[model samples]
Target: MNSLKLPDIAAQKLLHVTPLDWVGMCAIALPIQLEGRHVAAMADAGVNLVDGKSRGIHMSRLYLALEQLEHQALTPLAIHQLLADFLASHEGLSTAAHLRLSFEHLLKRPALVSPLAGWKSYQVSVDARLENEMFHVELSVRVPYSSTCPCSAALARQLIQRQFEADFSGEVLNRESVLAWLGSSQGIVATPHSQRSQASVQLRLRNNLDTVPVTELIDAVEASLGTAVQTAVKRADEQAFALANGQNLMFCEDAARRIHQALRELDIATAFTLRVEHAESLHAHDAVASSQWQW
Candidate 1:
């Protein structure tokens, strides 16, 4: 039996009509390579057409085009080019295109000794848009750290001191005796709660460039706060972590201020957003603060 031939849709378009304002898919998960590192990323691609009288769009074509981008480098420059190509493929249907990709960026870091280390993951997002022959890209990251409650620490110190005095009444207090008393339950009436904290920074790039170093950003954040959460730790590392936390006791406001100051020192533009959230262990609610560059 002979198969009947069908007419091509691209060639049979006889009706002239306005295109759609926005068309495409979202949350497209795929593997991507960045800086020679393979990572799983999700991409949201869409186009805005001059909508007037079109029944629908060729969604499969968009997905096929994105499939080509898979396994390829996803730098800022490459993303700009990809969006341009996507818009070109749509031809008269759209004059603008937008794409958003998000992924978990993993970095291997050493703990505070014990010869053991592991990877720490962060949430990264990249957004790009093309309009009027121009492209814009924005990069964002969420970094986690540790924040100690300064208020709680001060109160705990007072309570412990008071309890120590009461427990050692009528006994000659010496440095060793005081130390022993403090180590017992009678000395530490209360201990402050320092919770795990996270901060998000979103920066709008001036040009299509991948100059922003992810490692540098992570280092700056960890250094500015003087303490970071550990992925792998031993008994020695735990003790070292406690010491570090004691030295870097900070409030939520202090955490935000530290990040804000660090970002200002960077070469990035004065316009950016910094948000910090501290999940309080003492209370059911979290402490959050935000600071944005005015320029």
Candidate 2:
């Protein structure tokens, strides 16, 4: 009888292994700092199979690499290098690498009147791919705004005018009094529908650059809509918000076009996909419109 010693898997170098079509980890939870703010990010990483003949990848190595890069700010350049490092670590096992990172981006916005508003959270995702030694990056963001019904505003005005003429049939028509009445509660009795809406934007960067300020895009969208929905409110802020809703009354089509025009004016027209979803208050289902430019 003879005793045999087994080789250590952790210390021994992996050899003669076939390439994998895909290998790596997914849903890896880690803390990441974006724009000098620390946030939690769920990252997914994988690489294309090498030769279709391999047992499995060193999953622990993938985890460690991600942990090492977790605190580093994720810019376009950093992402490219990270992907390259991930592939190189597994050597011969994969050629192309893919990584997806999703997190909640907190944005601090000022109220229409109130001071020192808290931060608002937006859902954001970043996707990157490395193929043939070229890197590609895409950033996506979800923003919430307010949409008012245009038809409702117009119809209310018409009804108020008719009621005014009927109520003052026997009295002498004084322009000043009539105008005051019209501006009063009785003059504009219209049912206005307000919907909480969301806009999702995805931008593909040229030369694998991901430094495009996502917050700026979100701000532009909120500005284009004229107002963002408020989470916390006071009396003054509420009144200001009401004024905004009344002034910026829009249809679903108007919302979509506004966003499209905003993106176009920014000169990043050819590098993005835009999706606007209005969760309607007047209807049970949502109204959605999407468009993209070719580049």
lDDT of each: 0.80, 0.79
lDDT digits (tens) for residues 1-295 of candidate 2: 6678875454344566555567677889988767777779899988776754555666776677777556677787888888888888778777888889998898777778888486799999989899888787888899888888888778876887788877787999889988898778777666677889888888776554445467777888888989688866789999999999999988777888888788777643347888888898878999888877763
Using all chains and alpha carbons, the TM-scores for the candidates as numbered come to 0.86, 0.86
Least lDDT summed over 10 consecutive residues: which range in candidate 1? 7-16
Cα lDDT over the full model 1: 0.80
Identify the runs in model 2 with alpha carbons over 4 angstroms from their true place: 1-21, 174-180, 183-185, 208-212, 267-270
Residue 267, model 1: lDDT of 72
lDDT (Cα, tens digit) per residue for candidate 1, span 154-216: 999999878766787788768998777767886788988889999998876656455535666
